[model samples]
Target: MFLWRALRSEGFPFVKKILLFALPTRLGGALGVQVILAALAPPGQAMLAEDFHRVLLSRALPAAVDGPDAAPAPEPLPSPGVPPTRLDELRKHVSKSALGMEIGPFHRPICPKREGFNCLTVDILPRDQLLQAYAEDKDVIPFQEHIEEVDVLLSSGLFASVAAYTQGQEARVQKAEGSLSYLISSHNFEHLPDPIAFLDDAATLLADGGFLTMAIPVGSRCFDCFRPLSTTGQLIDAHTSGRVKTTLGAIFDQSASAATHSGGQTIGDRNYDVAQVAVDACGGMIDESSFGALQFTHEFGHSGGIHSFVFNPYSFLLIIEDLQACGFLPLLRVQEVIDRPGQEFIVHIVKISEASRSPLPLDAARRTELLRQAIAYYIDDLNATRQLQNSP
Candidate 1:
């Protein structure tokens, strides 16, 4: 029984073929008679015959009967009620938690009925000018309400005043140092001609462990998507050279690719159309004639006041990391990045001055490598999402 099972398990046809061809002629008749007896056995005890029949039906018989061109059986459909697993890992990374309890004076109850914490809100215009602008536009009323609650409203336009508070300004730095627990800027970093200086100033003002929370527009979803991603090198150059105008290339790209959110749709959906008028008026080759005419308009003409930089999340994080390594933004750790549904991302950064060790500077080559890796990762994530959506 064991020998029969082994032969059958090892594929009987090959063994049978070898035996039939290799057996001595004298023993051939004996083997053939045994095979006949096995085949003629009673059905109840005919296990070897049953096994042989099954092998023939499962292997050689089907192909012989159906021919070589038969189609394969259809695959089973995925079971219903089984949740899609594609985005589970991604959603975990993007989900928000309630603001951390350890955020020092900036801890929530961000808006208090009566002021309890010392906070500084930085803006280009002073309080009265901001109010006047608000008065002209009813849409600004909501912002005005929040501005009214601020303890100190600092104007960046007053260069001398800001210089007083920033590091290296001995007299003013001492007075303001570690005094402010919270500093909030909204939609302002992109307007700064020198973001490094602004960051240094904020770091100088913030108390040890204080929080700096800011909301910045995601460049790809904004009008600036047409513009190229700005690099730390570009920022360093602007800071060092005192360039007052956004490059002409940036201006032309912005104008040429200006887009607005489509009706009843979010920017994430890529439901947008070009603003043709903007292109007609502002987009053109920067030849001598056109350069002279368009030079002082749109982004370049506005004293670099338009979105001076463009960033997606990866690029933005890379800039922040490089800035910290360069010592332009020391001891600042990014605590959280919260994605807003249709608009911008909010970043919470904490100044961790308690640590005894200082941060090391990241070299230019390493910074570039890190930025490249981040961009590649983001691209891979986007490609994966697209592939998942297209799969059957």
Candidate 2:
């Protein structure tokens, strides 16, 4: 080894590097062990040349054999995206426990004015449903034309004129202190060219975190149903102007015009599908998982079926599912069915919040299952409707 080292250092440039590694490694096992020992344990009187030879030999180790730090702990693989686990986190936060409030007016569809129930009674049409409920009290506040004043308004041939008047009244009440809720007409949306802009204005009018309740026809379920020219005209104008942001429940048969004079584009026939509208308009602004069935037909002395998407539980379930998909936290507490005295149903109630994710307690598998079930239900319901239409 000493002779080999001397030859290596004495200007043997051609064989220097190769001999340094091969000589030590290729030595017989006994010599290899000896060389290793000598390199690891420098003698007290070790020569400078010996030390230099040992230092030069150490760097021949492979990178795989190097220290952990030297190899670079593989840069931690980056995240794929917002993980599924994170979406579940949002769901937990979206649960009912997240909200704090009593859901409905004490006597819904009953004039809150009479019982002084600190809640708003929402109606989609000029119906005296609530007024009649509290007529004994005569505490009616004639802010706008409800069904109580529908006859009067109709007699004046000024039904459309009352929409603006009601919007103003709702705006005023929304601004008032202790205003529990705001009522709106479904027709008002059909009347306005831009429902979103109108809703934004209403949101502004509301108390911060206050309630907003309104119904809309989901899609073009009505076929050749006659509606007033003004009503259809408003919708057409909106469509032409590009203000129609939703197609969930728009009238598809608007061309038939047979129903135009009679409000042909009305949402009826147990298929007035507006799931998409609820999602687009209310999902972001409200909690969708909180929705269920508000199934009471106590108002209007009959089923307050006006604007009801369908007259059954399944219809509501589909709607709630849509709301959930749209990221709203839904809370369905009431289940009153119209014209069905013995049957109980839940009302769909969702709260608006600052959060954008779902608050329901569901895993990814369960959520996907829910989506599947909803789609299946839609297919069945649509097929059933078609069968009914074609039946003798």
The number of the candidate with the highest TM-score is 1
Model 1 segments more than 4 A misplaced: 1-117, 141-174, 243-253, 261-294, 297-305, 361-392
Candidate 1 lDDT over 1-392, as tens digits, reads: 22244455646655454433344433222222223334443542243333332221111111111322221221232233232232221122111221111111121223232343233333445556667755866556655554432223343432334444354423323355555555555566776667777666666656565566666776655566445678888789877886544566555555545554334333442223332212223543436665565465744345434577876655776787777677766656665444443446566565555342267566666566556644543343234334433556
Write down the lDDT that model 2 would get: 0.30
Could you tell me the TM-score of candidate 1? 0.54
**lDDT values of the candidates?**
0.47, 0.30
TM-score of 2: 0.29
TM-score of each: 0.54, 0.29
Top candidate on lDDT is 1
244, model 1: CA deviation in Å?
6.3
Indicate the residue-level lDDT of 98 in model 2.
Answer: 21
How does model 1 fare in lDDT? Answer: 0.47
Prediction-by-prediction clash tally: 0, 54
